[model samples]
Target: MLLIDLDRFKPVNDLYGHAAGNAVLCAVADHLEDLLPVNGIAARLGGDEFALLVPFTGGIENLKRLAQQVITSLVAPISWNGGAVKVGATIGIALIAAESDADTVLHAADLAMYQGKREGRGTYRVFEDSMDTELRERAALEAELREAIEHGAIEPFYQPVVSLPQRDCVGLEVLARWRHPTRGLLGPDQFIPIAEETGMIADLSYHLLRQACLDARSWPSHLLLAINIAPQQFQDRDLAQRILAILAETGLSPRRLEVEITETALVQDLEAARTTLTSLQNLGVRIALDDFGTGYSSLYHLRELKFDKLKIDRSYVDTITMSEERAKLVDAIIKLGSSLGLVTTAEGIETDASVAWLSGQGCNFGQGYLFGKPMPKGEVMRMLQAGPRLEQIGISSMPESRIHAVPMEAIIHCGVGRAA
Candidate 1:
């Protein structure tokens, strides 16, 4: 039995449409049949996946040759409309071992196919027992994430976004933290990719967005709540409408909410993302390009999208003090934002020296450990009630100070002054 999976198939479905996707899948089936042996049969399992079965008790060399032919024939581009649709094949082979039943053989082949995918597509793998362990671990993580979302165990930890020089907490970024029962606490780095692959990202994002909005309602209307948007989450047609609903239900003003999405999200389908942002902006919401300088088309997106903020990624910030070239790049980014009338935010400012340097550059805002790590809502409220002074970030009376928008500190306690 040979199981084949098409690579780069989703992009075709996403960029083109189901009609294009179906045409490609049908072309693959035809290619498989044309290359099949006399008694060989090919069937499409689902989506862009196909299966080929042949009764062959010959040497492994013949089976290997057949697999190579299958890949070569399937890799050719298929005509869809006036354009060409391209996808590569990843194949897995399973031979009838001594005691291997139909189900067992099929399972083995599927595991090998996935291994082929991991090794990079356009390859093939023979069945092995080791792949099962990795698959099981992935399955377990997905199960935990589903349960956590259902039980509302995922909490939003708010980190302060401090206005530079002035050091006032003008905003808080809502970060997701999973309160796993056995694992204590888990960061997004650990489970977010799994959630995205398992199709739980939309559910997870909506859950957190709603909770973050509700939590921010108690803050002063002048303060903003920023949240990250996953790349796949933008593909949803109702994304903007859903955000407006969450804002209304949480009693948070649309103007006080800032949506942060990476430049890569806009690269998928520029037109679609434009519409989503335009709709959100129509609701009086603000848009920010998060993690700048990471994606392929950052400048193009910037030119096209009317973003209100440009967040300098931490990678660039980390090298500012050490590398002269990097320092110049950082300066240019800040200046670029200023020229465009955008709020330039320096992320991951860990040291007092970086903070001091950023303030000197006339940077608009900064966020990182120097400001404060993400904290519970109760802690944030207490800090707010204490007052807007942000001396806790170790920025007490700088050598030179110039007042900016609001006289607040880098701490979450922005002296929201709306009462505890």
Candidate 2:
């Protein structure tokens, strides 16, 4: 039995669309067929994965040759939807011995395929017992995540969002942190996918929203709070109603809350997403497109949805120092957002150089490790009260600290009092 795993397939499907994705899959199947013996069977197991069963009464050399052929065949570019798409495959080989059952052989092949994925892909690996240990560890982590959420072990961390031009603390982004009683503070990488797969993201989303609102209510009235909304949360029929109720119960103004959704969410079911978003917008809440340029359909969705804000993904920002292409892309996205009358926020700003470049390029806002990592509500409040500072030496200077110099009478007249 042999299994082939395609690497980085999600980005291709995401950037080029599923029709292109299907073309790649079909090409892979054809390649496998050409290599397999007449009795061999090739099947697409779905989503960039494929399986082949060959009557392997043959030597190791023959199996290696077949793997090489399959890889070489897949190297050719595929044309779909007027675009050229390229992809590579990783092959895993497992022999069906005289004593082996079909299931056992398939299992071995599957493990070997994953081994190829782990070993940098575009290569082949034989099955080994070690892969079983890694699988079990992942399973255990997933189970623990379920228990952690049930026991209210997840906590919120706040990241400060500073205003551009003035550089004042304008808002906070609520980030989820899992604090396993036994495992200490676990990052989202440990449990987020588990939450998504198990359909627990909706509950988690509501929990985070409520917690963030409640915390924001305790802060100075001028500060706003933002929370990420998973696509699954939108699938809930009563999501808009639930958010409205939460805002009313918390006595928080809807204007102070921003819910971020990715471009993928907008594309999944455009009409339904539009209705849901319109309802939220009607309630005075702001909607921001998260990871703007990362999605293939970003421009299409931007024209259709008319979101209030466009958040540039970190992938583009992270590469600005290394690649001019990324820098130009960021520049174009900022201009695009501006032309659409949308506020643009660049995420993952990690250095003085990047911040200077983005600020010069007319980017409206930025978020990254350079400003602050996500913290608890109290820490964020303290940071906000401390005001914004310009840490970069000799690049562009920050605007004067007029944010803190606003008179107490003006604040009172604005009807926003200091936090208790």
Candidate 3:
């Protein structure tokens, strides 16, 4: 038994119409029928989902090959009204046995399909006993995450982003940490995916943003607050408007907030991203292309989007000191940022050597544990109060007056923010 789900199918219905979407689904059904084995039966399970029952005495590799074929068939766009509709599929396979009930088999295949989706969509997975345990744990975690978001248990932590050569803390990146009652502090890796999958990301994100913005109001005017926007959130057409509303509510200056977007978000819908980003830019919000050089279309994004900053991915930063090739890549990226008149921030900077190398390469900013780990609001406030030592972080001291200059109008009660 194979359970298949079409990826990005909603966009077809949304962009073209139900007719075009139906055409795509019918096309998929035809392709599945052509590939079915002898005595194989195929049926639509409704809403872009399909099921196939095949009696196979063959090896598992044969089943894998069939799955791959199904994936490849959809690679070519479906022709519709002189336009092309594109979609992909993720399949979950389960072996039928005499003892397996219909509900049990279907549940196993469904779990496997979701696993495939989570591991980067457009793939296949065979049902496994371990997947059942994982699903249960995920469900439990999802419930906890919802409660966490509702009661403000998931809070933002701040990591300092400092000027490269100067080493003065110019801004802080918002990273989310869940203050679990029994488990203690939980990193974003624990709950962010669940939030994204369950359609809770928007609410979770806005809650964090509201708190982060309120917290930022207490920082110096010169200091900026950088928040990463998730790829899933880009699907929201009114993303810019929602952000504008938050800034208005919190009274955080638009100039002091930087929005970090990944290449994944840009590639999903470049035109839509452009429209949203342009709206934000027009309102004084700075944008940074985060995790640079990791994505396939980095140069294309640079050409298409007017980004204020380029963040060199930590993978390159982690090996620059040890690997000559990585060092050169880092150097090239920094020079690219400089030539494009964009500030470059190197992520995962740990050693003084890495810091020196980055500064020498003309990188504008640095962020990582060597500066300071992500801390809560009170710790951030204290750090701002007591200027960091030059000897400790290999930079000159920040001015005392600049550190203390939080405007009277901007003072407010603090709250948590960000997914790191």
lDDT of all predictions: 0.76, 0.70, 0.80
Compare the candidates by lDDT and give the number of the best one. 3
Q: Where is the poorest 10-residue window by lDDT in model 3?
A: 408-417
Off by over 4 Å in 2: 4-28, 37-39, 44-49, 55-98, 108-126, 384-420
lDDT of 1 by residue, 245-300 (tens): 88888887777777888766776667888999999999877788877887655787
What does the lDDT come to for candidate 2? 0.70
Winner by lDDT between candidate 3 and candidate 2: 3
- Backbone clash numbers for all candidates listed: 4, 1, 2
TM per candidate comes to 0.70, 0.78, 0.78
| Residues 141-210, model 2: lDDT tens digits | 8788777667767778765455454444455566678877778877665676568767887776666677
* Candidate 1 TM-score to native: 0.70
The model with the greater lDDT, 1 or 3, is: 3
